[model samples]
Target: MRRREHESLTAGPVCPSTRSPRYTCRKLECVFSLGHPSIARLLTIKLGSGHAACIRFNRSGDLLASGRLDGTIVIFDIETNGVARKLRGHTRQDWKCVLWDLQDGSRLRTIRFTAPVFIAELHPNTHLKFVAALFDDQPILVDATEELVVKRNFQSAPKRSQLDMDEATEKILAQDAKQTTTVTTFSPSGDYIIAGTNKGWLNIIETASCQTMFSTHMAGGVITLLRFAPGGRQIVVNSSDRIIRTVHFPDLTGKNVDFGNFRLENDHKYQDIVNRLLWNHVAFSATAEYLVASIHMNHHVYVWETAHNSLNTILEGPTEELSAVEWHPYKPFLAAVGIDSGEVHLWSVIAPQKWSALAPDFAEVEENEEYIEREDEFDVVASEELTKRILRQEDEDIDVLTIDPVKGYGDHQEGGFKMPVLLHQDDEDSEDEIEAIGAGQYRRKSPGRGRDRNTANEATHQNGRR
Candidate 1:
């Protein structure tokens, strides 16, 4: 990843109270609420009963899939601003992740585990592979292509009974508890799998055969979330330690590399030291140059520049607590769900650009200004000789857009246009005629069509003049 320069967007946000509606009349735009600060609110998909737990954007970004706390998943179409599909699973079933076909909202397959799964994600390239983290066991990779084949990604930790019992029992139990993986995710390229344990250890595993490539202890608290930058090299880890760490891997190519020398060589840590805010969720920007995390109970979202690891800007909006923030894949847009209202709050600065920018007296307005026309606005009186017409008498027939017609795609003979006409053989006055408009182009003339439309119009104009 290219290192971005230390930059600060320290512009103080417009407070929610003093800010006007519509967010207009401002040069440097600020965050606005939708139905509740957004300049252009695209969509607001509300869940039926419970709050949204997680949200993800489709590859093209025209659709949003949000999982609600009520065990229902809703796929929304942004263009229509309507719900496209609602999927529900795990009503009676437990300890399993059921994959569903979105097109018909039908269950495709289900992968069950002995232990409670904290999170299970399918490989980006193929749905047949799964990387799952268990509550009291190490993370494992499963090949669901045919049968239920599982492979433990990390080496099994030696049981405490096998070690010398010099330490206290409570201390030993605590140490053993940290051995299980709490969160796991596949790297951006799907070649490397990463798992975060309750003990704060980060393990990198090979996706092909589930081998441990690199392992390191990152924090003392449990690692809850792991997100990779758009680039495969850098990754951001969210843990219970109240700090977000962005780690940089040595390899750039997704091909096979020497894992024996793999290491967590470079990583940056970010935290709210002043307020000691607990981050709810963390995500990267579209370009992965900045990191954004929501506060526990705060309405603002903190953004930090990955280059200098300094605070860039604080997104201030949404009175209720914000959770599960998702950045649009290819835009400066962001969507955050409110904990209290279940409303998906959208934040974007894409204001309406119009020809008003060229007008010197243009101004932004909340409501349309009333227009009063003058009495002589449409009145006209003209009795002047045409100077241009006399200057260029032949200019009237000149077509500036004079260009050859393009060949039609459906049907055309070799290098020419040929149109056929049907005639009855009983007609005695029928005469064989053909009109050649261009080189190798012919039109079978109609018997009754003696004159073209322009020629007939010219004859009528002469009679009118006479």
Candidate 2:
């Protein structure tokens, strides 16, 4: 058996330089100056030994769980600014999940797998359980109370005698077989566990039955992160192919088909950059309205709006590369960003308004006299004409007529055809009408014109009406 060496670091108050334009720090408070407004860092706890890989705050915000690369899990009491318990296991591999006693951090449970664990997520409804993705293996659900694997997808290999195969052949076969689980997360309802593999496949398993509900390939590259939105109706995925996408999960109660069950709603492509650091970190806001992701090897974070499928904001990080980011569960306005410099920054979306020198004086009579007069004039006009203007009709009657040149002239009389009456006075007075009819705005009289002309005019008017 190998013994493990453990080390723990305590929190201390450190004030950063106020003159620096990028970061502003005071006692227990650090404000990051993004272009528009500043975000304040509420608390900072420095871990002395290994690089911090992941951090999670309990529901009460009194306890914080931080995991490191050296397989050391430390539980910090935020109220006291001290370490409550430090557990050591799975040397050299990253600590995937750490469950601590929120009341006093007395009871601690750490889960270690045969291969390194890439992702771990606590159940939203319960604190004593979590789901973890193991390297080259299926995901496992850990029971914190019993400290046992309640559910897992492990398959036992067939046993063989020594004569069946040589040791060298078995070693070569084992080396050739490679599988990896890159990321895993629990759904908001705690009924399903979502896991992603290196082959760009995602699997959703039922927690009660431990059966796979849906599994399908998502992208070409490895999947980096799988996060369920606050409502659990949708999930956001980040992959090594530089694509961030959102998938929706509808009611999957009676659906029998396996493949193509998940539907993609939106996606965003990130800029290409050459760096070895893992840029797959993604998080959703408390309200699930906005999503934040770290850029690969870049000192910037992208904030996206799920509704618009557009970039909403860019949060600037430190000069060093960003490692991870977590949003406050209860505080929708606060966010914690972790950088490579071993510093965890606290940022707030809400900023204080700074008073300007040209602010208006609301108390002075002269300053508001013009506004008051305009308001009075607007009120008088609105009351007097608003109703009338709303009720007034602007429609005009349009007359559509199809006239035939031959039938435009009335029925023929004994002398000549009776000319049609012009609706407009200008047309009646025109020289063209006089030359065509040999009369100005009048019909020529003939011997039998009285009754015949009247009957013919009445028939023509009736035909025009039809």
Candidate 3:
């Protein structure tokens, strides 16, 4: 078996980036064509305003959202090639967590804390609950069900923390241990919480109970990002230690299971020991078969295939260092932001069009071969009608070969697909599809399914969105 079966959402709320491709350069980077075609061309998306800090694509791969350094997020409509909307908000200082509504750019609720917060993430399954990394103490699970009264939840998540100890002991340990969570995130399924600390400790906590399930030491420096593959069986971790570890979970039963004992292939770890380069940001291909990361202060983007944990390709571009990098949700395409120019660079395979199948007389061969021409091949003097023809055949339909060779049978159900869905909501999984997140990581355009759904979307979005 390749993956574990898990619940899915119809168009899981996703965060946006893109428009048309403008040829920037002729230089192409490719190697082995591993699993997916190597990116053959470059496309550029330039926003007149601020530099892009992050980006995302809708399910159809026809829309994008680019969050800029100026605190404005511009949603680009790829179909019509226009800007859909721009989301922005007022800035504030430390010591509080505020939830803002993106639909109207309004604040939903705020949770004030005594100590400043480093980062926070909403539970994948709900909005009333969230996890926050404190600048002073351990992370906590907050329940904000008190928002109905239209006031902030006075009780911050400090009490509901992984260090679920009494007030006195918590304070004493906080002074002695001084352990702080540097990075926090949720699993794709939203059932488990993965967090890392400056001490290089990797941990998995249950979202339901806010309890630690597994803990292990994996790095020597502070951990920065923890991205679960869309499939949920794998996780890629970035740290100051300069190692990119692609973690694989053979048994994905997230209950009472010992994850510390999970095995990683010999080649699963990636690092530039000589340069000790830190990976700025890392992303998994839509199929999670490939991993791409932008190196800190470097002009190259590195891609690795997971099957063997080997370096698949190194995409070279941008004279300045590249910052954020993302893979097209459903295509073998990649987009990265230039640290200096603030322009978005896109890459995708552009295969040559072939029409030999339509013409019987034409044959395409790589190398020269002696021609054996038949006499009847060139004799076409008579104009004839079809032997037995009709205006059209109602019973016949075109069957498109839409199966992605990179995807397995159960995962690529082109015929079973529903319209306007970014994620496929299913619990059954196939062996090869164990890592596939149905419909890719996208959300419906009208994400406000209801008040509850909207709340969940808005809340979780504040956390690290993939």
> 79-106 in candidate 3: lDDT tens per residue?
3444555444413233555554433434
Model 2: worst 10 consecutive residues (lDDT sum):
11-20
- Candidate 3: the clashing residue pairs are 16-56, 16-65, 17-56, 17-64, 17-65
CA lDDT of 8 in candidate 2? 18
Task: Encode model 2's per-residue lDDT on 1-466: one tens digit a residue.
Answer: 1111111121111111101111111112445333333444454443332334456654434445565434455555544544555544435434344454433323266555555555566665566566666655656777655645465562112223345446548564463244456677766666776767666767667777676656566766778777777676778887877677787766444435343435444454443345534454778776787777776456666677777776666666455555466665544433333443444554554445545435754343435444445545645575558667755643544456743333422332123222222223121111112111321122234546477879999999999999
State the local distance difference test value for candidate 2.
Answer: 0.52
For candidate 2, report its TM-score: 0.55
**Structure candidate 1, residue pairs in collision:** 32-37, 32-38, 33-37, 33-38
Instruction: Please say which candidate is ahead in lDDT: 2 or 3.
Output: 3
Query: Whole-model lDDT, candidate 1?
Result: 0.60
lDDT for 286 in candidate 1 is 71
RMSD per candidate (Å) reads 22.3, 37.1, 14.9
Candidate 1 C-alpha lDDT tens digits along 1-466: 2111110000011111111111100012244322222232333333332234567776546567765433455566655555555566644325666666554456656666676667777776676566777666667787656665555556423222224445548776667555777777887667777787777878777777676666677786888888878777788888778888888866635476766566675568888798877787888887787777887778787777788887777777667677667776655667766655446666665545875768976777989889787899866644344555566785567677744544542222233322112222122211125344553254567756857877899999999999
Q: Give me the runs in candidate 3 sitting further than 4 Å from their true place.
A: 1-40, 43-45, 58-62, 78-81, 92-122, 127-130, 134-176, 250-267, 356-466
Off by over 4 Å in 2: 1-51, 60-64, 74-98, 108-112, 126-128, 143-151, 154-179, 252-278, 332-339, 349-466
Most TM-score-accurate candidate: 1
In terms of lDDT, the best-performing candidate is 1
Error of 2 at 240 (Å): 0.5
